[model samples]
Target: MDVREIPHTEATEATEATEATEATQATGAAHAAAADATAAALARVRGAARAGHPRALAWRTERLTALRALLTERQDDLAAALHSDLRKPRSEVDNAEVGFTLREIDHALRHLPGWLAPEPVAAAALGRLPPGAAATTRYEPLGTVLVIGPWNFPVQLLLVPVVGALAAGNTVVVKPSELAPATSALFASLLPAYLGADTVAVVEGGPEETAALLAERFDHVFYTGNGTVGRAVMRAAAAHLTPVTLELGGKCPVFVDRDVDLAAVAARLARAKFANAGQTCVAPDHVLTDPGTGRRLTAELARAVEERFGPDPAASEHYGRIVNEHHFDRLVALLDSGRVVLGGRHDRADRYLAPTVLANVAPDAPAMREEVFGPILPVVHVAGVDEAIALVNGGDRPLALYAFTGDEAARRRLADETRSGAVNFGLPFAHLGVPELPFGGVGESGFGAYHGHHSFAAFSHRRARLDVPIGAA
Candidate 1:
């Protein structure tokens, strides 16, 4: 079957309506303020960059060091803000957000000299050149960059790209998600003390502010959010010919083979899917397995959820609540889209939804149609690997894909056939921990990547240099 043959979901319509409603809530005066603030920030960054402040290796290193110190010193404050904004546990905040960011900083600092060094090109390719001729590709900073972060993983998503952009010697404007107001305020307030207010400015507001920011010119734009906002960012960047690296989410799928360890699969899936209330970009959106494997996996998954979040997940301190009422309702609507296998409890007042598993869901089910950025796990039974691949490829490419099997052929087939930002054999979302791996999406999931050298390259331009002999004759 053609990939486009798969039906789209109502979740897209729901998300667009939500985005429109939220974007319009901000007033005209707010838009004016956002535009003025963005303009002023852009000017300051451009001025600083022109003055040769951020270009120095020492300056870049110092700024990265200061950012690390900021995360370390303000860990408590950051965690508290995250809790207030997303109901994320302090431990989750530290491990998933702060720790990951610190690692990125450390990785960049260690390898930045080599990354910035000019790569020598073989002069042999240009036989017409004089004997003294030399060629090299130098990675240079993109002057002023904009980092538009998402509400989920607000701290990490916002500042990780800043780590790369700053390391590449560019001035930055960070626009944190308005959905996470507390974290946004914390970033705007605290970033100045660490990275210097003038060099890295944080603009905190809704879509109007983001739209205003995008209207201005920038050397590079890095955005992490839904496809709707991502398209808007791309359009705005297109007008100015600004390069963009979008990190959008999609319906990441997991294919399970009969030979897998059901218990291990359950533990890994439960940890990844339910973490941060399943608001992760790379989390497994759905599962495809044969009937026997599906039944066994579902049983194991129920036990895994009970083990992690306990019978009353709402009371479990480890589990998080839904980000807000809108998302909570979205998730609630999905529960009805499939047959519940385990844990369907919810509380709208607290914005809580238990780690849920829905079995025997149809391909056209609302929950299966879109990126289910929630704790709802829909297990759709498939005949085998071919069916699973067809079902997955039928939709837009996802940010990540998982196949659980010890068979080498199965792994190879999945790797060869599917398109995703990353593919893994045993677990999900752990690919993000490796700084060496580039993280982002493909197709509808997202475009471009950033992490390690990828981040440096993404934020920097490769300028070709040549030493042309004056006596060319």
Candidate 2:
């Protein structure tokens, strides 16, 4: 299908129509059937919050273990589905989505009990006035959580938080992105089969179904995607006062210091930057390298592009498509903003853009101003490290900030001065592998973290209790 940008009026109506259709088609049956199914599950969540039930928590954990097993057995199938939906290659999918989150589930399963254990807190002096008292902090599940996954990596985004909610002992209602319709349907079909339909349900639809879902009260909400839709999700979530974890995207910046290895940097950065066709939330949207070094980095990246994507990505199948032409055109427009140093070829039919590198670009150029999610790299030359930091911080807060430097001092300074969802010193995208590290964004990028303890925390609430037998006070 030739991709035409939907005008606001049409897009709004279409989204509404899709939502209405989804509610009428899927949600009606789901809501009617849920009276018995989710009620008891929801009661467990409530009891977990008020009375703190160990058995209920254990049951949720057991369900998680079973689901993790299902996720593990179907790794290849999940990877293939992701590939079919987003054109993600197997290796990248393994490294980025499948292996990463699967490993996360394994880690969570092994330690979830310890995490759920009530934390002991030192008692205040009031307790010691007559007798010493010990305090324990309780972690309880939010009754029901709404998780909205994005199209970029539908499975991981959806499953990752599901892991967290399960660990925290909450029932989840997942709304996968309609953009990746096949994966959405596959997930809807497979989840109910692998796990019970009552515990975890998938309501697949576009905006209106989402609006209705958002209209209802959820104890917590998790969303992953662009800032625009993120705002809408946040707005809807606000109506219910539902606490949300927004995992949105922004223009993640890469600062290449003058004192670094060009070839090694190219190898590491090229892999991270272009993986998944640069649609990654933390992918380097633009590069800020030192004077002359920017040009050198650009040239090196251009060479790396050829090394990575070959002379002609249009004819290559190893490289993935633009997912859709809307993104294809957005990337092509960035190409027009600057001098193309390396590759600039677009085949709309295939949704292919040659691993493109643009240079001599103004700082405010569309190539620099926007988040170039395709295989496009823009190089901006700066006078010094200060200028680079200024350039980086000048933009809205980004999800990820990458600084490449052998100078430990510069690296630390960059870390201190720059604020993002996460910061990496070297070896690009290394944070993705940190099992303990939380992945998320700040300001416009996103609001919450996932992958480790961060995920569990996002799905659960900390409720303080004054249980001094009602007399100690």
Candidate 3:
């Protein structure tokens, strides 16, 4: 019989099956190509590192300067890509991603000379040596390293580490997050042009490409994401005995004292929590306050949200959408876990979730179960600072702990009692802007910190050198 003579349903099924098979084959081929490209890039970067091309101060300076220029020259391009990926506002893209990275590059460039200088060891510390003996510690590059970036704040999170790696005079292979495909493609295309193809290579793909890159040996692996993948990165690095710096996120908590300025506290909290659609690593995941304070703060927070995003945030130009449908759905479900006090509207089609505040949230609510990396802010009532401290101590250490209080004793108590990566007295997410502070997590958040001088240290090996006369030893 002729193929046209077949039943309509049967023919449709046959065609669909054939298309599926073809798609599967194509996907396999693409993954294979990505793996091959990653392997080749690693080899090229390693070769460059061995050639000592990146070790020169001049070369490092040129790369840093180029990185800054790239950010400045392509600010609009980056902002557009970020908007495509996360619906990020242009102002946020400028201030948070491009501007943040530019600051890092500038700091590294300005301090590179002083940071690279060898530190002399005291004679008292060098025991059992000749009188003329001297010791010094030099900051040396860790050779070709791999930097795996996260989708949230893709440019800043990924390139900030690159600044340190390059500043430390290391050839680098960067793996941009596949979720942010626009930014990833942009980086893949632009990095080679700006930083040279041989010294710095950008590998673009998802888990497959990352797995392939992880399988290969690297001097150091720097990852910024969650703990699940952070563990995987650690495991892969273990095979090669490679050191890794994991910048992972957890449920950061905030405590609102009844004595503080409710309006100011609410404003800061709203700004920090809702920014980037609440996808920030250090954003306040939940609020702990007394029942009265919770009720009052909820009203203030509602006012703050309206003031920031206007009556209808969905219509606001400054408001952002969720990264994707999965996160959107996850956040939508959390809204049911507590009483919605403010914005709770969401549209899956647009991946938009309003800056929602959940009051009367039970401690064991679904939203409280994990890090709510969305625009859902859960407010749980506590007895006071003691209860807040207890709750914070009970859970895994957070990446940041925020408190709004005028009492010095309360501030000191929170600072002294909590085991977090950072503690802010009256605000949240400000510590990251300070280039001098080390930014990372503790416990489940992840290990290893990086920023400014800390970034240089993370990528460098303090090689100890000893000098003595021929017979002095």
Candidate 4:
């Protein structure tokens, strides 16, 4: 509100100080004065979004409509950036990162109207009111949105939420992780030109800049990263009283039932583990299979990893490197407690680590204790599904859970007993392969859901509106 709108008085015999005055001010004027400064700024963003102005909506039907074309046109650029920064392959880029993101753009464009439409109500509550009353719920924009994305899958982590914000009629400010400098810069440069600056703005920096952005009041905040930073983001959002949806990493578990298909499990586990060198948040941290099954899986996965990326990830161009030696050393130090069953080689200069899977790991071992985001998968042997569920629930809730089984009853039991936000049955790692699922975490893994419609709703406020029939009598 302006100073004139504050109901201020000049100091004199005629002017009395309101702070010390015991007299009452007009309620309407008091409400106007109490209106937060951020309300107007947020309103402007909502207005811009509603207008779908050329400068505001930016990409609109053109980029949203031609997402595949744009991605195909710029495929080399994206792949090159990921390779330069993360050491991923051209094929991996198209299938994992670019593939799903472009698909999300297309999916959101096609279903955006359904997402944005105000919901209808049954007037159930209105029946309780005196004869002529009625009520209806309305949906609307949350105004300005803040997205704090992670270094791993930096492009998709950031833009996926932006897709939702834009679709739900809101402007977004994306803070891409500085760890992946190349991709971050690429997004900063590419997004604005393709999608205008007014609707979407990318601020490229580290924690300090992120802290500054968090300090600024916003209508909503969506963060994707590790739990430590996610908690800090939550704290900052709380200070501003801003509602946030945090997508954080956890030790997602994978259970292999006795009746499971060993060959298919080996192939699926290998793809998920070595996809980005196992740098993904929902990547399976450890496996719990029967002693017989665990041993077989270990042998099969070793072969699968070798088949997919060859004997040495250091020499394989397909295998990605750790973001830095710090993370490489972190994983290296953790390997001391367990017997290295597969690969454990690391080269600092190349920043390469093999698809290392450790066997005979004790529950208290470092690999089991925390999230091993590297290519190392520790296969922990348990008797059956009950033991596996107990082990999974022993720690905090993971972002994703994978249980491979042909038994229908056992699958439902596993799903019910666990606390993960998402569960995949009959597949080792189902988080990435399925686009229909909403991905997120619970408890320490983090809160909020994203992907498809779940994300579109995350950046919007579910406005509880009531419409009363004027003369129903």
lDDT of 1: 0.90
How many angstroms is residue 101 displaced in model 3 relative to the true structure, after the best TM-score fit?
0.6
lDDT of 4 by residue, 1-473 (tens): 44455544533423355543534456546545534432443355456665756222334455464435556788899888889889877777887788878878878888766665667667675676566554544446677788888878876777778777776667777788899998888877777666655566677767766876788888899988888888898899899899989888889888888887788888898888777888988787888887788888888888898788876667776888889888989988988857888888878888887888788887778888889998899888888888888888789888889888888888888888888878887664566555567777899888888778877777767776665566655
- In order, what is each prediction's RMSD in angstroms? 10.7, 7.6, 2.2, 12.4
TM-score of each: 0.92, 0.86, 0.95, 0.85
Cα lDDT over the full model 4? 0.77
Candidate 1 residue-wise lDDT, 13-56, digit = tens: 66678788878776556667767876776778789988888888
Q: What lDDT would each prediction earn against the true structure? A: 0.90, 0.77, 0.91, 0.77
Models sorted by TM-score, best on top? 3, 1, 2, 4
Which candidate's TM-score is highest?
Answer: 3
- Residue 355 CA displacement from its true place in model 2, Å: 1.5
Better of 1 and 2 by lDDT: 1
- Model 2, position 73, has a per-residue lDDT of 84
Clashes of each: 0, 2, 0, 0
Model 2 lDDT per residue over 116-228, tens place = 88886666634553444556677787777878898888877788888888788777778899888878888887776776665677877778667767776788989888888
